[model samples]
Target chain A: MKRKTDVAGEAQSEGGLAFHPLDQFQVQPLFGHGPIEWYTITNVTLWLALAAVAIIFVFVVGSSARKMIPTRLQSVGEVAYSFVHNMVEDVAGHDGAKYFPLIMTLFVFILFANMLGLLPGSFTPTTHIAVTAVLGFGVFLFVTLLGLYKHGLHFLGLFWMSDAPLVLRPIIAVIEVISYFVRPVSHSIRLAGNIMAGHAVMKVFAAFAPMILISGIGVLVTPVSILAITAIYALEVLVAFIQAYVFTILTCVYLKDALHPGH
Target chain B: MTTTTTTTEAAAEVAHETAKAGMPQLDFSTFPNQIFWLVVTLLVIYFVLSRIALPRIGGVLAQRAGAITSDLSAAEELKQKAIAAEKAYNDALVKARAEAAKIVAEAKTGIQQDLAVATAKADAEIAAKSAESEKAISEIRAGAVEAVKEVAQNTAKELVAALGGSDDAKAVAAAVSARLKG
Candidate 1:
């Protein structure tokens, strides 16, 4: 109770009346007051480490028993494994199974990070464009390199849709090339944008929670804000899982393009 | 009011400084650290999954599949045994019924044979009794014929004596005997 009042006082002292909802996304050095150096450990690092540890706990330690009948935690691990496994296989075909581990790693990492962010005061590493951009660019680079290696110069054929009119072939090829390069941008933005928007909205609704102290209309607005927060929180949970799925399946789709570079 | 305004100005400066820091995600300074950790964490997870977790989980799944297949095969074997047992039971039952019918038929024939022998023996005894009764009846008829001859001879002699005719014993005997013979 004392901590709550102190935090409220701090917020008031810091111009709480003009609270910026996006302030929650600010990254700062976890240690002594100083500019964040490249080597400085931040909240992003802490939460990301926690997310990785959570994934390892569920997958590695939970399945250490390797029981023929899975425990609850092991079942969760297996479901995640099979879910990504099927995605890679179904979308990218048997050739995609080879990359299942890579795709699975991305999925578990992002999934845990997203879900962990739902905890109050926890940082969401996935909401950052930097992290998502890394993943997207990594996938883009991997697929592009794989396609080039496998098909050599023939890989360029993917850009040319032979079904189109020969007169329009060059134009279509240009469009395809542009879209192809745009994959990483859209991929990173989609996940980071969705996660950031959901978190920001939640924070906005939470900011209105202080309206309850306004006396006259506080009582009515308080419940409505609380309900909105609850609703958005629920939606964010769905968004977290959906964004992870969307990212993984899209990776598989790009892998398919690499594997089969034809129309 | 002046002190309050100064405090407000100070707060605005702080807020401005915070805003100047901008979105941490956009902060170019933090990228290397976040990316570094991301690579490190991803590499760690990848190693764990690829080296340890996935293979173990896959082994469990494979073992489960093997167990199911073995169980199904065992069930199939047991079903075959059951079918064979049922067939053997049916065969034994048929054999038992046939044996019972054979025994019944044999028993019936033996009884009929004994009955025929008894009937034949009874018929032989009846035939013998009728033969002896007929012989005795013939003997009694012969005796009655001899008595009747003797009487008839006596009557003849009396008749003769009353009429006052010769009454010689040897003549009378000879005449009587010759008339009887005739």
Candidate 2:
């Protein structure tokens, strides 16, 4: 109880624990204290750098040998390559295979970012709306442009339901257009939200882990919280992988819609 | 939500020092910075993958597929060759068996011809020897009959002298011959 009151000021308005769960999401300069300028190298930059290095190590250096029989890292690279490749080819259609590099870029970046963020004390780039919104909106714009370029004015036919009765056609088109615009928002939020929720829940449970040292309830609360933290952390690793996969597959689906924009 | 607690600049500063982390995600001030870094990261990743990584991997994958396909076709070719070789061997074997049978038949006919000639020659030799033996027996019988006639004449002369009756050799022989014939 003494420790609780002593450190409660650190947790601020959150009375129970000495730490805030959302604090992990904060952006700060990597070198020292400074305002987070657009050009400043921050923790986000550091982790992003780490993600880049990881991609290079696995994809670039790993497959450098290009052996008929692949090494472990090469095998891993090939599996990831083909997984995204097949996904694009399957979902985005045969013509969509041309965009393999773009889809692959998104998938690899998001995947690496998500996986790296699982390290202790690490910042999750995907957890931020700015980051995901960029990805989501990026896909949205790319798909829209692709549709417009390929189908021209007919691309607008995506929202037009010719099958619907003439009276309800405009209403349905309005609904479709709204849904179409919402793709980026939902696409970005889904990844960011899933990752944020899991991490926050883990932080909350982790804060309770010190209960054993502070209160009589420490005996039970502390162990349970620790166990909960472990379980959630494991779940977070899964969420990390799943979120990356979800974001990529959705990109492919949107690409498919762009390529063959009919009914 | 927690940022609402900051009623003054001092409180916000204190919050920064303390748990003011608030919804750091919602802190609009960091948006530009985050977006900037995120763009740089994405662009870096995009280039690294598209230019360096993806092509290398895709090439390796395509190369591997090509190798596997070629290997399979080679195996199929080898299998076909093996099948053809086996057929040739069987054909040769069948031809050799037929040739062996033909040689055996030719040898059997030659042996039969030789055997028939030998059998005919042996039968002719046996017939010639039988004719010669019959001629010799006839000659020996004629000589014995002459000796018996001479003995009968001598014996008839001795008996006539001893009995003081007849002494003619010709008459004795004629009478002995007539009795033997009867």
Candidate 3:
């Protein structure tokens, strides 16, 4: 008794967005009553929200009872803190400590979000270009403003080194400017692409889990697939931390360049 | 040319209609969407983490690292103490062994002195006993020789007195005695 079009699969989802292979990255608009049109919220927002909440909870509870003798949770918090602190110091030096709050927050939030997304039914916020771009642009702007504020017109030296010879200055400047503009694109794409690809692979593998579970040969594959899943899960966890670390470290490097721009 | 233009126009119109029908009006091109989310994220990160959560975590982490470092330093100090004690023990053992050898040498020297004194005393006693025995034997032989000479002298005197009444008897006695003695 179904409709003729439904049987033929001619119809689509009510949203009208096609079910493309990578539809998860597309932005959908949200409608509201007011003049201020609400942007449609996606699973990415929820993932980030959950990550922030978890980070807040862990830190808050961990240090609630400030004691001379710390608990295991406190030690974990300390290790995370020192790790980011040392990284900042190593990349950005003493001045980098000023941005510790930002860097650490970014690292922990992204890490938690990435790891959380690996969970079944969870969405990875970084998988979306919008989220990654925003983060990348924030860093970009912050570094740019910081550079201008710190060195004024001298910031142009980042593009064309004043110390370079006149003959090669033009070529070097062109290359430097292109590289500079490409930073945010690469940064954003690196995170988004990695997350999206990993998730897609996981999803594809997971889809086969059911089909393989039915056939007799499927039984043999169950253990292998399970092991692969487990290993992939662990790798995702590592990737989460590494990507976050890479992002933070890159930010630190940018901040360093901003603080002292030249060659 | 006119037919081609007309056909192109019709095709464009149909394509537009199909596109309008197929896709929803998703405003992904707008800047407000990105800006709004960015601001929200910034506010969330700044306030929630910086104001509330970060401080707590920072404090906890600081305390934990401090405790760890202190413990490590304390362990290092203890290890140094242990090493120093071991060195001191070894030194004392070496000193004790040297002291023991010195004591043994001193005892050996004292024993050697005692042995020398004992040997000297025994040698002197033996020489004294030998000299005393030689004196005793010489005295005993002198006494025996003196007694034999006295007995021979007495027998000759008695034989001379008993056998000889004249010169002829003296000569015959002399001859008999010589023959018997010989």
Among all candidates shown, the one with the greatest DockQ: 2
Give the alpha-carbon lDDT of every model. Answer: 0.87, 0.89, 0.72
Q: Score the docking of each candidate (DockQ).
A: 0.34, 0.44, 0.16
lDDT computed for candidate 1: 0.87
Top TM-score model: 2
Instruction: For candidate 3, list the clashing residue pairs, or say none.
Output: A78-B61
Candidate 3 differs from the real structure by a C-alpha RMSD in angstroms, to one decimal, of 8.0
Cα deviation of A84, candidate 2, in Å: 1.2
Q: After superposition, how far is residue A244 of candidate 1 from its true place, in Å?
A: 0.9
The better candidate by lDDT, 1 or 3, is: 1
Looking at model 2, the pairs that clash are none
TM-score for all models, in order of appearance: 0.81, 0.84, 0.67
Alpha-carbon deviation at B136 in model 2, angstroms:
4.8
C-alpha RMSD for every candidate: 6.7, 4.9, 8.0
Off-target runs (Cα >4 Å) in candidate 3 are: A1-45, A62-79, A162-165, A197-242, B1-26, B29-38, B51-136, B158-182
lDDT of 1 by residue, A193-262 (tens): 9999999888877877877665556688779989999999999999999999999999999999999999
The deviation in Å at residue A24 for candidate 2 is: 1.5
